[model samples]
Target: MMKQIEIRYATDADAVSLSKLIQRTILASNSKDYSHESLDLLCSIYGPEQVAERIKNEHILLCFEGVNPIGAAGLRGDYLRSVFVEPFHQGQGLGKLLVGEIEEIARQKSVSCLMVHSSITARRFYRALGFNVVKYQSSPEGPTILMSKSLS
Candidate 1:
């Protein structure tokens, strides 16, 4: 039997699990491209408290395989944020599914365009999703590729 996959809007109750999932993904997948300091800083930004706050303010979605939260992504206004998938689950289409759902949400809100500050590790993935690089930017956490996709 195949595991059932479900994607749904996240709630405050999911904060702790989501935080752990994001932190784990960052350390495992993003560490290859970012410094230890950068990874630490990024992980700090996604702690349970912060994620709980974001759950209240943004459209955060969690993808579950059965009852396990395997992936997540968020949309705040026109910007896509915090897209992550479990390291062991990469290359399984979960990331693409999460982003596709985010795009549809943006379309429903009449958003003409969506933007993402892609981590160095995810730049190619974003490009493959049709986002064009707007520019490169530096932050305390590290370098990022700012990319955008038109919904129209």
Candidate 2:
């Protein structure tokens, strides 16, 4: 049977789990969309120090099935920083659910705009969700798109 999942606002205690989720998901799946060096850099950014800083400044949501973390999302003001779901758990609608959860938070906060630096793999998903590509930029890591959706 498929595991039941839940989404909840991340607390300070969740920093480690959230960091692991981001690192594990990226290492297992997103490597194809990013170079090894870039992936490594991203993983390093999830170290305890960085996670602690982000936790204090941004809103994070953690996805779990019971006590096991399956995904995570981070929002820094108007920017959607990261959205990652374990490969085994992808395509089961959790991604959309997480995005919706973020939007709900934004609505309550009265944020009228949402933006993300989208990976190649996620551009289509964001597009389908009503975000448009405002521009494409080349990064030393690879290619990325600046995407935005107006909340109004």
Candidate 3:
């Protein structure tokens, strides 16, 4: 039998689990492309408190397999942020599903474009979803690819 899955807006109560999920995904998937210090810095920025603040300020979505949070993504204005999936669940199209949902939400809000600060690990994935590179940038968290997609 297929497992049940749900995607919905996240609540403040989900902060801890979301934080853990994001941090774990970063360490597992982004470690090869980012420095250890960068990973640590990114992880620190996603601690439970920060995640809670984001949930309150951004349109954050979480995907659950049964009751376990398996994926997450955030939409702040026209910007996409903090997209992550559980390492074991990667490559299974959950990321695409999350982004599609975000796009739909953006459309409902009259947003014509979506932008993402894509990590090196996620550049290809964003490109596959029709986001074109705007430029490359460096930050304390590490190198980032600025990408955008037209909703038009």
**Model 2 over residues 89-132: C-alpha lDDT tens digits?**
88887888888889888878887999999988788889988899
Across residues 1-152, which tens digit of lDDT does each residue of candidate 3 receive? 33778989999889999999999999999999999999999999999999999999999999999877999999999999989999999888999999999999999999999999999999999999999999999999999999999999
* Candidate 3 ranges beyond 4 A from true positions: none
TM-scores of the models, in the order given: 0.97, 0.91, 0.98
RMSD of 1: 1.0
Clashes of each: 0, 0, 0
Candidate 2 yields a Cα-based lDDT of: 0.84
Error of 1 at 70 (Å): 0.5
Flag regions of model 1 displaced more than 4 Å: none
Better of 1 and 2 by TM-score: 1
Regions of candidate 2 where Cα sits further than 4 Å from its true position: none
Q: After superposition, how far is residue 109 of candidate 2 from its true place, in Å?
A: 1.6
Q: Predicted candidate 2: what Cα RMSD to the true structure?
A: 1.5
